[model samples]
Target: MLLAGAAVAAIEILHRRYDGAVARGTLLDPSARRDRTDLDGTLNYLLVGSDRRPGESGPDQRSDTILLVHVPAGTKRAYLISVPRDLLVSIPPAPNGYGGGSDKINSAYEHGGGGEAGVRLLSATLARLTGLRFDGAALVDFAGLRQVVDLLGGIRMCVDTPVRSIHTGRLFEPGCQQMDGTRALDYVRQRYDLPDGDYGRQRHQQQLLRAMLDRAGETNLRDDPVRLDRLIRAVGASLTVDTNGVPLQDLALTLRGLPPDGLTGVQIPSHPETIDEVSYVVLDDGGDQLFAAVRGTRVPGWVTANPRWVTRL
Candidate 1:
């Protein structure tokens, strides 16, 4: 799970209890997603992590991370599904009627005008690709990640492999350790040296989110008024979400009550392939089976059969 998508879940808990502390947006197009008529009662939220850096000027042209938060009909558990940004797909045209063709999935942002428009087009592309409808979407950045993690007094992350940050040269040994915001950002961005490369980074990203959710579960914010206020404010500003016209408070209420540790993270089965000298991810036949299971709200069954594909989050 990307920080932005994790922010969606975190904000859901905060908004449910605190009543209104998160920023909201109109980021989805009602007509863009698939009609929910044929599929099971599954709710999907598109969490997009924009590639804009801390000092970069101008709009984000690529999505560094893309995740789908899937809540099955009973809402007993949620799945964090990672979509590789380099996956090749046919992008749909923007609302303004410009730019649509076979391209990397991350390029949808630039092709769709780079803000809320980018989110809508990305959602549309995913909907067409997965035959899934999005109930909501969110755009989250890394700067807010620093604020919230620091505000919470940092998070505990267990690194599975030794990673040296490419950005800061900070060595993260293979063990569970407490990490501040800046270190967490740098750690999550170290993909090049990992064993599974980007897939390993995705797993690290997913674990960071689970840690945030877990740490937040441990804190009793109401007991500390000052921290509570600052934390709420930080969380509220970190996310820009569209609940597809559903009230944020109501959706939060509906989303609460799942076990704090019940999040399941999975990556679609794919392999890196070079097409015309350009790298792209091509999903295997198992991805089709996984999508079929998701469509029927039977991912548990899919997981049981394809256990290797499920990341232990």
Candidate 2:
């Protein structure tokens, strides 16, 4: 434990001095917030994957991927909800800098720079749509993502359906297996072959997450100090967390109790709907009830439908 502490501290210092530019602030005083198990409010986080790669040139920047995480207090159980980027909902653009009226949620990032503008738009939209207050956020780049995967050595995953993509050079046979950083990235990014398109991609990501968690549990960090240090450094550098002013040590302690099976991953309830000749994922009754439940800190009506997906309270 002492060694792990020292290693994490060293990495934090190095990152702050060199590669650190993710400034932390919030609508609420996150610094003063505590992760109370007794609180009725859900702990929400927005995970955005920016489409700003130099390899793909585009004037418009969007979140290629979006994940909303909700962790109820006092339980090891957690929920991850993936939002489709092309769902075509009204996105309130940045106020001053990127005023283009309501558009797709992805455009908010293009209007506002990748930093504060994007975060503000996302958080505000979430509050309006779900009536739930988000407590923190974590941002990561492709490089940071690669580092995290490598740190885990590799994650084992089972391919549910055949996913073949010529662009990303990914081909998977349906079965359980191990995936390295490169393969894992390709798997999560592949959407062309899947039947549900972006929805399928989200499912794949969630599956990978489950496999990674399982691997994380089995991993023995104390066996290799060098590797542990490398992982700690990579994770710290890769994530931009809005920890509500909570100390790093305290946060770590909070996460200590989480188990692999404790995580419940769900996609926001929506099916394809056409509007103005454009396809949109209109939220169904399930979606509305889910958000309502989140706001009320109670199980939504759809929760019963997804008995397998929702962790037991």
Candidate 3:
């Protein structure tokens, strides 16, 4: 049943429109002129959650959520490493020929024009930071996330403590419960009220992801074509992939056998510090070790040794 949901999700992604340059270069090195086989090594995908709304425009448009998904060669397991948007890093010059400096990592996206150029700059920045090249890039609008959760009949999540959304003023009680689209969006967007701040929000985001996977396992998407179609349309409208030209179906097949337990979520190690009176997350030495493990495709070993870095979700 989970496989069917995965297939349905893949089909929806394939049917959706995508950018041309996302998958244009070598899988191991996006800047490489030559193409590389996806089967040869681990695949790294940069997933960005854009906070901008439809038709919204401004310099404030940034990736509120950034994750590097590492899929090992055999596709037996996958690792998701979350990069805080507030992480201070050096941004490369934008394709539009403006803006470059040490700032929040997400600044690259905003300065690069919020499209392919933004993705390129951000991907380059990530490559520089992690020493891992991207195989592909995916962008999901916040609006789409809400629709996807709602379409899946509201994902189930456990609130360890009462959560009052900083954005929406919505309150979530402590317990396992189903959340509608609006409620779910509010649930993941709150950070200020939590003790862990942004880290707590990150955990909620990861929890939402896990809930989606669990829902997929419980629901046979194929059995109800109508619901499946709605889901596909909702997802298609919200998600965009830069596959370069790799056939979407093939990529889907590569991921078909992935089990729920195979997915692991880890937070990039960082410490909070103020730079020139502005706050930022500075990657610690452990972060270097984590990225090295990712680049070496030895995340399982890294996780075993540094268990604290792994998110319990």
Candidate 2: residue 23 lDDT (0-100): 38
- How accurate locally, in lDDT, is each candidate? 0.80, 0.65, 0.77
lDDT of 1 by residue, 50-154 (tens): 766554434446777888888887667888989887888888878677668998888887777766787788888887788777778888875678889998889
Instruction: Please give the range of 10 consecutive residues that has the lowest summed lDDT in model 1.
Output: 31-40
Q: Flag clash pairs in model 1.
A: none
Q: Rank the candidates by TM-score, best first.
A: 1, 3, 2
TM-score of every prediction relative to native: 0.88, 0.81, 0.88
Global CA lDDT computed for model 1? 0.80
Query: Could you give candidate 2's per-residue lDDT for residues 85-167 as a string of tens digits?
Result: 66655555455555546555566555555554565676666555666666566655544566677788888877778988756
Clashes of each: 0, 4, 2
lDDT of 3 by residue, 1-313 (tens): 9999999998676466332212332222256111454644678788888888987756568878888888988898888788888899988776588667888998878887775566677887887887766767777787667888887888888997787877767788899988888888888878878888777788888777778888877889889988887777677677777654567667877887877777888988898898888999899999999999987888899999988778766
Model 1 spans > 4 angstroms off:
1-21, 34-41, 53-60
Error of 1 at 132 (Å): 0.6
Q: How much lDDT does candidate 2 score?
A: 0.65
